[model samples]
Target: MDLKEQYEKLLRYCYMLTKDVNLAEDIVQETYLRFWQSHTYKDTNKELAYLYTIARNLCMDEFRKPKLDDIEDYCELSGESEYEPEARIDSLVIEEALEQIPKDLRELIVLRFTNEMSVTDIAKIVGISRFAVHRRLKEGLMLLRRNIGGEAND
Candidate 1:
């Protein structure tokens, strides 16, 4: 993908991580800036993973800051007219279900399904083993299914 497309995807991923639009944008910009400023930009093959690592680290830094407010307060309802009501409802339902799961599992679920990231890429981003990524993904999906009242496979 081109830089513009990659930027958009990174923005979405950061949004998923931070649950705040402005913070996500700031983190994404800093991620790109840091990527360009650092020598790690030479590796073309692992660009996305590197970008994710930077964004995730920036987000973790933000989370470490002293803040008594809840991140969920930044959540906003979409007013876009393009999506059908059922689709929006389903999205909201799934998002709500996602909120009920553990944060680590939710991150894996979002990375795998929401952002369409590969397990290997996710492993690299999260600094975990590929087998662990797969295992956690399965556990996450099962929990999501249970939360959404769907028929979960054993």
Candidate 2:
């Protein structure tokens, strides 16, 4: 697949994880930059996974930083109507629900759905077994459904 074709996927992957378009764009650009800067950049087959890994690590680093309460006063992002209200609402709901999940589970859901990556590829990226990937994906989506007002299985 063309690397350019993966741009939107990468953007969505980062955005869902960060919930910030500007940060997502930066992460996508940095993902490409890091790939080019590496000495082991010859492998074409692993490029997609490598790009994801870079983006994921960048988001992780951002999450590790201590957040300031005052930062919110100046950090609101503005945008126009790019998506339909219903679609946007659904995304907003899902994102909010994702925030309630544990970080690890949220990562699994983003990688599986936003990135459209297979369990095997996710396993490789996350350094876990394929079985663990499947288990986590299932558990993560279940949590999302419940959080998003789906019929609770209780």
Candidate 3:
């Protein structure tokens, strides 16, 4: 797969980590820059995993800094009439539900579902075992389903 194709997925992963779109975009750009600069891309077969690892590390480093406040800016979707109503509504619901989950679970869920990454790849990116990834994915999906379902019942 083309590294460029991973841009949106990587951005989503970073956004999940930082909860800030601008910061996530910066992390994604820095990830690609560092990935190219390190030249590890030439040796590593898991390009996506490597990029994700870089972005995750950057997000961790950002968290270590003392920031005044975390501005929560969800719903970055544009209010355009071009998008289908159902799709837009579903997107918002899913985004809202995802925000309610634990950060660890949320990141795993995004990597697995949004990025369409395998359990092994996710484990490598997350530095956890495949078994742990599976367990967390199951738990996260259950929570996500409950959250989405609760919204429907409301």
Score each candidate by Cα lDDT.
0.79, 0.75, 0.81
- Extract clashing residue pairs from model 1: none
Give the residue spans of candidate 1 off by over 4 A. Answer: 39-46, 69-87, 150-154
lDDT of 1 by residue, 22-63 (tens): 677889888888888865555533567877898999999988
**Who wins the TM-score comparison?**
3
After superposition, candidate 3 runs with Cα above 4 Å error: 40-45, 69-87
TM-scores of the candidates in the order shown: 0.79, 0.74, 0.83
Candidate 3 whole-model C-alpha lDDT, 0 to 1: 0.81
Model 3 C-alpha lDDT per residue in residues 38-143, reported as the tens digit of each score: 7766543456677789889999999888865533322333222243334477789998999899989999999998889988889999999999999999999999
Model 2 spans > 4 angstroms off: 39-45, 70-87, 150-154
Ranking by TM-score: 3, 1, 2
lDDT of 2 by residue, 1-154 (tens): 5566677788888877776677778898888788788736455346667667888899889878886456564244313324322357667767778889898899888888877787877887788999998898899888887887752332
The whole-model C-alpha lDDT of candidate 2 against the native structure comes to 0.75
Q: What is the lDDT of residue 25 in candidate 3?
A: 82
Better of 1 and 3 by lDDT: 3
